[model samples]
Target chain A: MHISEGVLSGPVLVSGMILAAAGTTVGLKRLDYDKVPRAGILSAAFFVASLIHVPVGPSSVHLILNGIVGLLLGWGAFPALLVALILQALFFQFGGLTTLGVNTVIMAAPAIICYSLFGRAVHGATRKAFAAAFACGFLAVFFSALLAALSLIGTEEKFFKVSVLLLTAHLPVMIIEGIVTAFCVAFLKKVQPGMFARPGMTDPVRGEKGGGK
Target chain B: MTIMTRRMNRPKFRVARMRRVGPVGFVLLLSASLVLISGVPAALAHRVNVFAWVQGKRVHVQAAFSGGKKVRNGTVRVYDSKGALVTEGTTNVKGEFSFGLRHKEPLRVVVLAGAGHRGEWTLSREELSEEPETPASHSPGGASTDTSPVPGKSSPEAVLSREELRLAVEKALDRKLKPFYTLLADSLNRRPSVPEILGGIGYIIGLVGLATYLRYRKEGKEARPE
Candidate 1:
């Protein structure tokens, strides 16, 4: 969900940019050199995913996949999502450049939070991992929607109704993302189990401490 | 082959089989579900877009989503260059709204389609001007020598006063420019094509690659001994 330009006030935009800059700094620091390719791939996934519109009730919403990105890349989701948002702004004007910072924070903050919440649990056994991944996906969207609504509320008091509608509209997206993230997690577990390992650790070959906490 | 080969081959085969049956099949299934879900006729992604232009002494606006669905019953607000509210109203069923031009300065039109979706377009002073710099007298019908209406043979234009004739000319110019206005709206409302989507993805990859390269170089230097 992208917030278009001119909807936010000057103070909100400035503060958003400041917070986003700080997040990017920490995200880049946590982004190891070996993880760059993974981050890049996820960034591309995010870029493509947002274009695939899934029609819900009155309005349609697209895949964000930020939850998957967070589960896999941890703090790296910030820079990865920022890249995707920049491209969306430049090419499709999905969100304007002036509001890019706010949009980035709106989407990426929840992603980082998801990473902190379920990043480790996603490496557990099948059932546990699936549950955690589902929560990761579901809560990521829910929190991002909440943050988006909060940003709009900061801009104008009249946006209260619009904010509520936005949250309600995204409920289906939360469910869809939860299922998708679960499937993706299960797939990754089989193909490249090392992805779920904690950062700074060597790849866990089969039978070694494969299941992270 | 020994037992080692059999043991290794078993997991490899299972993994390969799982790959085909898992991620790939899941992707296909997801695509199929998306296709089926999107089959509903009312499926539309709502990205509000507003386009406005000056017509006569009024500013007309059209607001719609990306898929060309009208944003019915939305609020349309016009703000002057000073950031003051000029006028505000609701869009009609056709997602169209109009208001008399109250200020000489530039105006910004914002359409609120509810659900946190908003679109905006601005009308610059030059674009809003109804008359060109050249005097109307220099035009073909500028000189109105007839002071009296010819009875029983009067055309509507011939009976009008100078001001009414100018108003009529303005109306005619607006009619002539109707196509251009439509063209403007069409261009503004056009959705991103496939190439644009690919290009956007390419840009994301390029930026990520740059970041990766920089990080790699820095890490390489750090890993090396002086």
Candidate 2:
């Protein structure tokens, strides 16, 4: 979810921009030539995913497939998500340019965190991989919501007490994200297993470069 | 579950899972998402917008999201140019609220759709008096407060034909142009069109190609180490 412009305080917005700039720089440096296409594709996916409203729920929140982005792209999630967020701000007005940095961090930070937590586990057994995928999807949105609520804390609106209220609004989105991520992981495991390599672009399945999980 | 049998195994199982929600499922989901994202997209979270203006005797406000969804039950706050709260109310089911045209200076209307989403609109003092002002005096209170036709009819000496004609025309115009306000808000915050989305995708693709080419050059045009 995007925190619209003018909602955050001045210092919060500035800090968010600094963090976003730093993250993007690191992401670009780590982005290898071969991974460029993958990053672009995932960027497009992140752009389109936020528009896909979960049809199963009455609450109406869209998918933020940041878990898949991080699963595939490591630190590169920052740059990928930043690009998508810019387009969304410009075209969809989902978030404005002033709030782009905060929104980018809101989406990408959870991705990196989820990737760190469960990156390797996806290569395990089918059931375990799916479980990890569900966690990845669910928690990515969870962290996004928490971060959003935290950002709102800068406005001095009883941050702790109100954060739970915000979390309940995101409950439906979290479940749907979990399901979609599990499904996508299952699908990708069959069609393109090579996409889920570890850092430095090494393959874990064949153990050719990554030297086994 | 399709995911359980989705692992590499008997070709029969792979086929069956594929027949269900495997890669085929991805394709189905992608198509459905494309359809939903095409036009008339729904569910815009945290994108609130407010549009308010002086309409007849009241200042009307409308709040909506980028996806054409109303910001239902949102709190509406009115403030003068100095940012002091003048009045407050809650929007109805249609995301609309109204307040008396009491202020002479510019007024700011802020709508809080909750969850850190906020939007504001401003109305000028001149627009509030464009309807009909009490003749023979320039007091903004006299003009903004006593806009009722009942009082205008009761006060025989204070009535003017031009003022009556203006009020009549404004009331008729307000009714006729009511739908246009929604249109104005829609156009102001319309969602990305298909071409705009395609263009964004194109930019990503182009950036990908550029990054690949630049990195390829840096690596001395090797075979990508595949």
Candidate 3:
């Protein structure tokens, strides 16, 4: 998921960076200072969740909980994910420092979309928050993978092949991430029902906080 | 009768013939000689060998070239145990690169450079028997010889000398497998632990707990409406 330096072409990289910056700006517009600490906590959770490596075939893959992030943070997920990626590049070297902007956009864009579309649907209607979380988690990862696949399409003759490889490569990891997020959301619901039931737990829905269905 | 005899004596006529050869004949001869000469190893005579060690998280690699044209753009990759790419860097203007590794694990360090580079030594923590005696000594008497090789030491397969590590890495890149090498290097650099994962999970839980407590506390205060 960490797009190394020199993977994407220059024009694509630059364009992605521009879009990411715009998205982050839009996401940050309505954030209140009081919500800073909670946002920071969510970002940190997303960051560390990627560290747990599970063995697959001859290699190992880690969890990327971009879906959970979107479900919890809503619009604020974009900025939070962007910050987390930058921090990961700088401190952990998970990805290259030079390609930080591009990587941020690739990972965060789908998360924002998922939060906007699925966050409310899963949270407002479904009493089964875990199931909603599961769907969001799976779809967000799938979308992020799709966006990456689309980025390479038509540019390289091997795009289709690489896309298949990448999608298949992430399937197992995505399933694991879905399960983890479902359980995490269930735990959140039990311990702090307000965190989800009250809209104020997140930036976009801070006024109403969480609205239990 | 004399004039008739002179008119009958005509000069003998001669015809000249020209022959042309096709280009294929010339090209075949040239290509054959090239194919014959290609089998000789003399064309690749010069290479370098590199030996590297991580001393107190600092990489110290020694390079010795076996007499050849100078190679450029050498690279080094350091990996941790889990096959993640930790660090990738290029050599300096001096054809030497030293990296201060941030990871502490049994690392696999790959030094890649161009052709003519070959490595001959692997220096793990246990391999340091005694320092090879060198004539270039600063002290007149015997100086304290540091003999312990660094724990995480790996040399590239082809490098015969320490200097050729850069070329090997570059060659690996041209082969389209530098990412795998980078992963190997990262695993050599950082020794990631299960505790780290546990701690990460622990931290997330701790934060959620704190946030939930604070949210309830804030809600209670807001209900009173001072």
Candidate 4:
């Protein structure tokens, strides 16, 4: 979810931007320039993926494949995401220039988690891998939704109010994203199997049978 | 009336006396006259409003104005947390403007909204920091640290005269070093546009196609070994 300029205090926006710079710097330190073109391509896919919209409650929801980007690029996803988001901010004003950092951190954290935890496990066994992929995608979206909810938590009393609104808004989209992630992982298994072989692709691979269904 | 007289001299291919026209022609004539009369007054009322978001020596200003009138000119100014003026200049027509700090230290900025507009906000570098920092100083640098309010003139925090604010913004804008501006300009160059959508789509298609070709090619290699 995008945060408009002026929605957050200048201090918060600035702090977030600073953190984003640090995160991006850390992300860049590990980047392999050979894969940069691929990263750009995937980032573009991530950008366009969100354009495929589905109506949820009163608002429309779309896929945020940041988890998939994380799975593919690891730390590189942070910078890639920053680029895509900066573009989105400039073109669509989807988020304000001031709040870009907050939005990036919100969207990218779930990606980092999903890639770190579930990415490799998804490559281990077809059914198990797809299931884990689905869960990871779903969780990333849910976590982002939660962060967005938490951002507004102080302004509105009771977590339930924001949680209910956010979860309700994201429910359909999360399901859609989960299914897409599952299919995409399955597709990758058949095609670019070496993608799974990438170093640090995921945190230590999870046991096959124990993976989420 | 003065604004109208200036426009009349430009050149007109068509002219008609509205009062002499028949009822049928009157409505058409009246609409035509209104359309011609409405143009210049709207142009005269136009003025640009700029909102500058400053981070340290780096700044980005966005311009918007009433009735879709584009920003013609504006600038930004940086003051050390103190009231002393640091630097100023005119902005590009895009309404985008920038400035830099040599020290990499935080500073304050007083943005003149635009030409002929009063100044608002005494923005500080702390306002643009990504993380909180301990504020170092609070003076107009070399200028008298006079926090004393002038009776008729408002504090810089409250507002400044339009021309003074314009100059302040100009200083803030012009003070940016070329290198930082170049980096920002380069990033902006890579910025995606509607045309870039083709590139995005092509990338996805290539990914899928490359994956397919690689898979088929791998299968062929395995069969040859067999």
Residue B220 displacement in candidate 3 (angstroms): 24
- Which pairs in model 1 have colliding backbones? none
Cα lDDT tens digits, model 3, A39-118, are 66667666665554444432234567787666666666677777777666554555556556666776787777766665
User: What tens digits encode model 4's per-residue C-alpha lDDT throughout B1-226?
Assistant: 9889768944441222221222234224323433443343221111123455554445665443322233335455656655566667655666466665444335554433321122223445455553222222322431233334455544655433433554466557656644565455333322234566565556545654665676678889999977
Q: How are the candidates ranked when ordered by TM-score, highest leading?
A: 2, 1, 3, 4
Best by TM-score: 2
Off by over 4 Å in 4: A197-213, B1-226
Q: What is the Å distance of residue A202 in model 2 from its true position?
A: 5.9
Which is the better candidate, 2 or 4, if ranked by TM-score? 2
After superposition, candidate 1 runs with Cα above 4 Å error:
A158-160, A197-213, B1-12, B16-47, B102-105, B131-184, B215-226
Q: Residue B83 deviation, candidate 2, in Å?
A: 3.9
lDDT of each: 0.76, 0.76, 0.53, 0.56
RMSD after CA superposition, every candidate:
5.7, 6.8, 30.1, 23.1
Question: What tens-digit string does per-residue lDDT give for candidate 3 at B1-226?
Answer: 9877666653211111100121232223323422343233211111234546543335655433322212235566666666576677765544455666553455555544421122322445442222222223322232222112432343332123333443456455535653553343333334224565445445544655666677788888999986
Q: Which digits, one per residue and each the tens of the lDDT, describe model 2 over residues A22-129?
A: 999988887766677778888988887777664322224677889888988888899999999998888777778988889889999999999888888887898999
Clash total of candidate 3? 49
Determine which window of 10 residues in candidate 1 chain B has minimal summed lDDT: B139-148
Q: Per-residue lDDT of B59-118 in model 1, one digit per residue for the tens? A: 889987776667778889888888899899999888889987755689999998764578
Which one wins by DockQ: 1 or 4?
1
